[model samples]
Target chain A: MRDRINALARLVPVWAVWLGYGWVAPWLIYRGATGGLGAEPIKALERELGEIALQLLIIGLCLTPLRRYLGVNLLRFRRAIGLLAFSYVCLHLAVWLFLDVQDAGRIWADIVKRPYVTVGMVAFVLMIPLALTSNDRAVRWLGARWRRLHRLTYAVAVLGVVHFIWLSKGFQIEPLAYLAVIFALLALRLPDSKSLERRTR
Target chain B: MANRWKNDLRARDVTPEAVYLDRRQVIAGAAGLGLVGTGRAARAKVPEPNAWEDITSYNNYYEFGTDKGDPARHAHRLTVQPWSLRIDGLVDRPGDYDFADIMARMTIEERIYRFRCVEAWSMVVPWNGFELADLLDMAGVQAGAKYVAFETVLRPEEMPGVRYPVLDWPYVEGLRLDEALHPLTIMATGIYGRDIPNQNGAPLRLVVPWKYGFKSIKSVVRITLTDTEPPTSWNKANPREYGFYSNVNPEVDHPRWSQATERRIGGGLFARREPTLMFNGYADEVAGLYAGMDLKTYF
Candidate 1:
């Protein structure tokens, strides 16, 4: 019971950051639109969301690393972080689909014609299955395949990075840092499990 | 593929590969592409003129203001009339074109273009303008003029963004000689039928469709032809993300994300995102300009 409480405690901040990001974005947009914020409120919102999504995903990915390095072993917090990351991304997408385009045909033309949207769409689409299987029942039902399927998160990480990199138009310092973290995490996965254990020790 | 219907009905599969590979009939496939969420909700009537006034006013030029919509609202006080464009630098006809003279010399055509910001969201705006090439020709770009640079009016009184050096003041943007000449590039005077709103780069602006939206410079007070490449505001702010061409190409992803596809605004629930095209579908017309150059490198 004490261990469970500790794990839940570890997840609280991550959830706050995740949920807080969504709640703040529209307010920012409203502020921007109402002359409370600077010139491009919508752009600001889009940027802020993109950034938070990447950061949270990185934080969620870091759970395993945190356990190994700090000996924190907050394994229970993992699902909550993953779910929160998914929630934030869903909100990020909802804002784009509803607020910006407002036209059916033109919006259709853009998704069909534009590439960044394609990669982002693919990333979003792949995420749905992962989210669907996130619960314990779905994981149990799928059994071993669940691990294989959830491996899509790796792709999600890659797509998320690509989505971010392309959105910036130029190299941005923040996304590069996320990429480095992902790279280091992924590089650790390449060597044998014992190798990581040895290094951590 | 057994899932022909699924593949057939997928949005953004307009690429030649999908067109040829999917065994679906062409006409039905085309209709499916267009008709997603057709009867769901009553389509909102296109905003009437000045309908966007409230929204357009708060534009973010970064150099003008950090707020996205700040430029439009703040720029309302800018003196647009009595404006004369200084056509100097590498132009043979290096002189001024009074606002009236420039307006009288050109014919206005309305073109509806999809504007995709590098940020991923997009808007479709109907812009009224004259071909930019016509004006460039009148300016008589000298032989050495390989680039065109534009300068926006900078005043701290109206635009507080000018106070802090987010970018060099009197924001500048540029284009290679040919990209400037592309027919898709325009000197915009009006949008949605009225004068270009102050927030939307009123009085006059440049619209480069193939490129990201910022390539479309707004509220132009000066146009300078240069032999060397001009420093664009976003490019100067972050060179890797905002390139000189800054054209909408899916393959050359921005450093933050892939440009492989974009979400068109107004999509309904379950509406799939569309794939972004190379050269924003102007390859046949403008592809020759880039010829053998490496897009990945230039990008």
Candidate 2:
């Protein structure tokens, strides 16, 4: 029964992403369509998608720590989590590129001029390679190099936190909380967890 | 209800986002100071404009939370019924004016103004209010008064985010005495002919159309006329990013965002970005106020 439950749980990541995209994004879009995005629906929608993407990335980063320290392995589902996070990031970028900022010409200026936009674009740039390499054939062919390359995910996580922290106007708790959580997860992967890390490898 | 306060403002005159870009350059080239004004006679009548963007209760009050949607979701916890504004400092009649009494004594008017946020978003809102100058007149400003400072209500139990140091609580904003007394500066009581929504700043708020939205402090409870500039909340939080004289300036870019263009609210995802105006297109009326002083240096 325990083994069955663990097997069932691996599918949770796949279903979770589907649920998030299928339900959450559309619900917000519907609310926006129905005049629920408040005085500035476009802005609200744009920010909301970005937030969801950031949260999913944060969740994806949590898998390693949860297994090593807490003795609960979601290792089998890490691919799903990573892919889901990538989808969200893609959606977030699409919203900004196509919807929020419609002018193709002005996009370069925003990416170049605004610090928040610059940091966010940097995050998107780091995410593109990671998203492209999220398949089994690539993972097998690359082998040890694949793990080394995938380690760039940590930088993606760092950029994600930096992007959020810089994007906010005033001092905020949410962005800081995300920073703390990401750091804590990275900290848990240090020297002491060598045995767990090797086993996971 | 929204139609009741319909003053004769051309929809194009108020929004003017799509048409404003090149038109401004032409006007600037022709007039040399960009004052080929909206060119419409200011008339008063039923507006019958589109619905008020659903006013869907979303707000961006950092004292409440940093998120744009956080304020509307959380501001309802405020207990507003028995509210009173403490009018003090540099004024003769320094006392708490109960909400009911203040409403009865004030002369209400409809002002459809172009609203701009410091974050480079813009909206055209029809605000219902009495002139802030009239309120100052009622308080009999002392000769020494140099600035009119304002503060938002701070109730920890009611305002959940106040517990966090999102900002130095009891949000404060101030305006120069002359700016405070300008006819365009108003103490808004309502919008779209309806009582101001809690998220929109219930009971009372300031509306300085020429300045960015932060200058229009929300849920105001304190009005202090002072001899010096009062510390504004955002400026105190980050001076480089937010100036006390947060008048909409396309020339002076915010450290983080471009002030050159603004996306009009409710124009959906593909809204045309309009060139931001100097003093948010109230350059005709308020530009003279800053005649000699360099806005860049002050900003």
Candidate 3:
């Protein structure tokens, strides 16, 4: 089963994944521009972009677990997934800055004053270094430090979910569900008791 | 109806039918001309009532569901025909008031007023209903009454949202006696000369123009004249975020978001966010209601 999965993964090109996922941002923009996203299109577009970015982040996090537990190694496409998630995050921020809240001063005020907005901004800022160093050259240059730097993804994931939960009105389950899923994914990454005992021995 | 308050906003001020009915086509055309995000800076000063589609379709009536469109989709299941309102507490003639009888007795009139939401979105609506003062008077408000409390219908089988504790069920809202008695306050029954669609609070709903839209509770089932300030649903849910006196003051920002500006519904995708007015542009008439008090603190 593992060999079959590896063979199938080899058939799909990383460039194909990049091209297919990259089209989502432009497609969402087109829908918003043409009024296909319903009334309050800008808000809908912003939310869709944010959700897609979150999904991509979740998918990117699943790559290692998929390989470890199932021996299904599609690790080659992780870079594309990570870059796509970053691209979607950038699109989400653009829609919010340019379409939703168009005032520069107000945007600054929100980032400084609003707790949810501040959390979201911090997550986005943290993503900048990770995105900048996603290339093979940086991995080769930094060696062990590159993996340490990429661990920022864990902080970004938590902050993103926190931002979602804080911005939601009343007691909503949707954002909380995302929080649960992200927590579960992070928990899966922790070394098991047996593994810890073996390493200590 | 002759003595009724005149409509300062005329029918022409309503969003154009072509623009609303074929909104996508119009937006597509605008996008073709590179005018999509140009903003509404050069437009007329008078606020336009949103299209009937926008008014009825977009709502925060969580009785049906939390999403804005959920009410429109699920409200049809609501039975509004057999509706009756219970008027009790501190009233001389306390009893169940039949909806039909109440409609027949009251003088219904048109009121085009600005409706602002706490989420910094707004719309102008032409509400058709009688002054809430008239209804309270019919129930004979007692001299000891200091506040007016309202309750929304709670049918868990019909209102799917009530199945969950999204908010404490049987959504409640209240206003100080003077605010409830204000002429600007009405029990809205219809929109644009038609019976309000179930989604937009059919049968009966409070329309307090000076307050945030949530304070104007929808599908009201009970009203009580009380001697003490009553707890409101949103306030009960989050005291820091929602206050009892949720008057629309641009200066008092919601803890989570700024209330300084609002995006007008039916203003198209690229229209500029307009600065929110004190009392949602009815400050001249309603500002006196909050005199000698700090709105920021109350908010």
Candidate 4:
């Protein structure tokens, strides 16, 4: 009990951040539901949530790189950041499916036919395994294979950026700028000694 | 394929053709060149000029750039001054028309039209320009001319996207000659009581609100009359994704998303998308022209 309590203590700050954001999403939904969103509100809400999801994803991806660079060892909080990212993504998908599309056939087609949505769906699927295995027991049971499986995060990161760029119908630089920052951070892992830990071990 | 889809949807009996016909007349009138003879005019009810204007001026042609608001923001880098429109192929007069001379001789007029994007949001705006027929007449199209292709300016220095081939650069769009000469088709220069901002396809742009936004070509530097369906930039890049017609119909959804509704920009969250209209509500004037034809196939 004491050990579990201590573990919970370490997770508190991350949960607070996720909870704060999650709390605000409902207020936004309420405003949207009550007709506060106005003529183009559905799209506006979807766009806002999509951006939030992207930011959360970026933040989650950043945690690992930041830990290594800063020597902060904040790996304990990575799971929370990732789960929050997934939660926001779920919200984004919900808004699109229910509020925007409102048609299951079309939504299913989008997931199947559209390259952007396909990649996004794949990234989401990959995330599920990571999220499921994030607990201590799964990590211990999976042991050596677990870290290898989680490396799929890099693939998810790349897909997330591609999804963003694809969604922007026109050639705008804002998405590109986001991609550049994420790319630079992820690229650092390519030649780093920490990434090659197995050989040294 | 487009025709089959429309026919299949028609067979579904969910959306009535009568409802679609009500709006089709306006689209035909706007798209009909002066050639839409007198017999056709009396049969179709004239649509009232559109009443809104905010959505007309703001747009994004991914062929040019990607922000929903970017075209109206970056379009100015294209210099309209000393503009020369090169007209060639299947035309009696194959030459360049200087912008100043064209503006000087053409009868310019202002018409208020509702601009509906395929995205489903819309705005009514008054635009000032000459009928495209007037320009085509100036060039004197020949008997073989079936389509008029418009080429937008390509300059990496001005249009940064040119270097990347994000799309087949120097976007190309075409219209059937009749469609090109439609009374509603305008080579516009100004909007909202002001000279069009650089971002709004300044110098000139095509305005075909009934069709998808891409049909309204921008920053055109060349016009070529051809005998065959011209290869459109978007269609060439992804033919299955973007058809030649690209008409705005909610019933026919995009492969990746539904076309049933669109968010009118500037409207807050939770707002429902307005129902999409057939031929963007101009079917009455144009439907009979394709009475025996299939729109889904052409689209």
**Fraction of native Cα contacts reproduced by each candidate:** 0.10, 0.61, 0.55, 0.41
Summarize candidate 1's per-residue lDDT along A1-201 as a digit string, tens digits.
556756677767745645655576567656654435433344445566666666767776776766666656656656766776777677677666665444566556666666667787788888889888888899889999998898787788878887776654323355667778888877655668788799999
- Cand 2, B chain, TM: 0.84
RMSD of each: 13.2, 8.1, 2.2, 10.8
Per-residue C-alpha lDDT of model 4 across residues A45-121, encoded as one tens digit per residue: 67777777777777767766665565445566678777777777788788888877666876787888788888888
What DockQ do the predictions score, one after another? 0.07, 0.42, 0.65, 0.30
lDDT of 1 at B201: 78
Better of 2 and 3 by DockQ: 3
In the range B1-299, model 3's lDDT, one tens digit per residue, is 22245667776665566666776566667768988655343234677677787788888988888888899989999999989999999999999999999999999988999899998899889889999999999999999999999999988888888776789988999999999888888999999888989998888999998899999988999999999999999999999989888989888889989999999876655757889988988887788988999887898
Candidate 2 regions with alpha-carbon error over 4 angstroms:
A1-7, A10-31, A34-36, A193-201, B1-50
The digit string of per-residue lDDT tens for model 1 on B148-215 reads 88988776786766676556677788989888887777888986566887778778999876778778
How far does residue B137 in candidate 2 sit from its true spot (Å)? Answer: 1.5
* Model 3 lDDT per residue over A1-201, tens place: 899989999999999998888888888788776656756777888898998888888898898889888889989998889888888889899989988899999899999999999999999999999989989999999999999999999999899989989988888888899889888888989999999999999
Using Cα atoms with residue i matched to residue i, what is each candidate's TM-score against the true structure? 0.56, 0.84, 0.95, 0.71
Alpha-carbon local distance difference test for all models: 0.68, 0.77, 0.87, 0.69
Top candidate on DockQ is 3
lDDT of 2 by residue, B159-274 (tens): 87787887888899999999988878888888777788788888889999899998899988999999988999999999988888988999998887778888766544445577
* Number of clashes recorded per candidate: 62, 1, 0, 34
* Model 4, global lDDT: 0.69
* Model 3 residue B43 distance off true place after TM-score fit, in angstroms: 4.4
Task: Rank candidates by DockQ, best first.
Answer: 3, 2, 4, 1
**Runs of candidate 4 exceeding 4 Å displacement:** A1-45, A65-72, A102-201, B1-57, B61-64
What is candidate 2's CA lDDT for residue B174?
97
Q: What is the lDDT of residue B165 in candidate 3?
A: 74
